[model samples]
Target: MEIKIDDLQGSGIIRLLEEHLADMHATSPAESVHALDVKALQHPSITFWSAAEGNSVLGCVALKSLSCDHGEIKSMRTSGAARNRGVATKLLNHLIADAKSRGFKQLSLETGTQAFFSAAHGLYAKHGFVDCEPFGDYQPDPNSKFMTLVLEQ
Candidate 1:
């Protein structure tokens, strides 16, 4: 799989992001769904990436800069056909390394507490992320689980 920065203009990526938003809404209430739209992903503070094989998009992830020493993970999704193939894992590892290289002291993310997101929680835990209080503009919500990994400088 070839993973690289994406412009968020390709139809494939647009469609995938739409699907991601749809899934988030389906899994959580509208107010609880923090997944960003494609337009939001294009903001100057966000870096987007796509994983592909040949011309087929396999997965995508984005890293959003929260501060000089902090970053947030966003828009992590793997194609339905590519689940369990390490697509999200590779994208996450790539983002973590990039965050460290960029001098970020912490990487944080928010996910759902539902069973639908249990795998995600497990994945983050496997990567050494520990539970944390809400960060950024987030508030305490029973439906939301926050995790963070502190990077060694």
Candidate 2:
């Protein structure tokens, strides 16, 4: 799989993002929904990437700078057809490596508390992320679960 910085204007990537956002909103509560739309993902503080095989988009992830030493994971999603093939894992690993390269000391994320998010939560845990309180603009919401990983570098 090739992971490349994404141009939000691309129709394929845009469609994947739109589908991800819609799935999140449909399964998660209003306050627990944190997936960003194309406009928001294009913010200067966020770096977005897409995992693709030729012309097909397999998955995507984004890193949003929260501070000089901190970053938040955002908009992580793997295409339905690409599930169980380690696509999300690769995208996440790429984001984590990018954060470390940028001198970030911590990486955080927010996911749902429902069973729908179990695989995601497990994936994060496998990468050393531990449950934590809400960070940044987030407030405690019963429907959400927060996790963070402290970078060794």
Candidate 3:
């Protein structure tokens, strides 16, 4: 699959992101859903990417610049058809490498505490991320689990 920066205008990717937002809301309280919508993902601080294999969007991920040396992983989703095919893994590895290249000292993310997010917890753990206290503008919440990876340059 070819992984590259996306313009976020294509139907396949738009649909994928919509589905991602839907799932996030369904699994978490409305006030707790931090997943960005299409417009939010298009903000200047965020860089969005989509993985595609010949027009089929395999997955997508985004990196939001939280500061000069820190970033937050956002919108990590693998298409249903691409699940278990290493799509999420590839997207995450790509995002991490991009963060490293950009001289980011750390990368962080927030996922739900529900069982629906267990796979995401495992994936982040496998990449050396560890549990962390709320960072940025986040506050303590029982429904949210935060993780961070300190990029070793």
TM-score against truth, every candidate: 0.98, 0.98, 0.98
User: How many clashes in each candidate?
Assistant: 0, 0, 0
Query: What is candidate 2's lDDT per residue for 110-131, written digit by digit as tens?
Result: 9999999999999999999999
Give residue 147's error in model 2 in angstroms: 0.3
Off by over 4 Å in 1: none
Considering TM-score, where higher is better, how would the candidates rank from best to worst? 3, 1, 2
Global CA lDDT computed for model 3: 0.96
Question: Considering TM-score, which of the candidate structures 2 and 3 is the better prediction for this target?
Answer: 3
lDDT of each: 0.95, 0.94, 0.96
1-153, model 1: which lDDT tens digit per residue? 999999998988898999999999999988899999988999999999999998789999999999999999999999998999999899999999999999999999999999999989989999999999999999999889999999987
Error of 1 at 13 (Å): 0.8
How good is model 2 by TM-score?
Answer: 0.98
Model 3 Cα lDDT, one tens digit per residue, 62-112: 999999999999999999999999999999999999999999999999999
Query: In candidate 2, which residue pairs clash?
Result: none
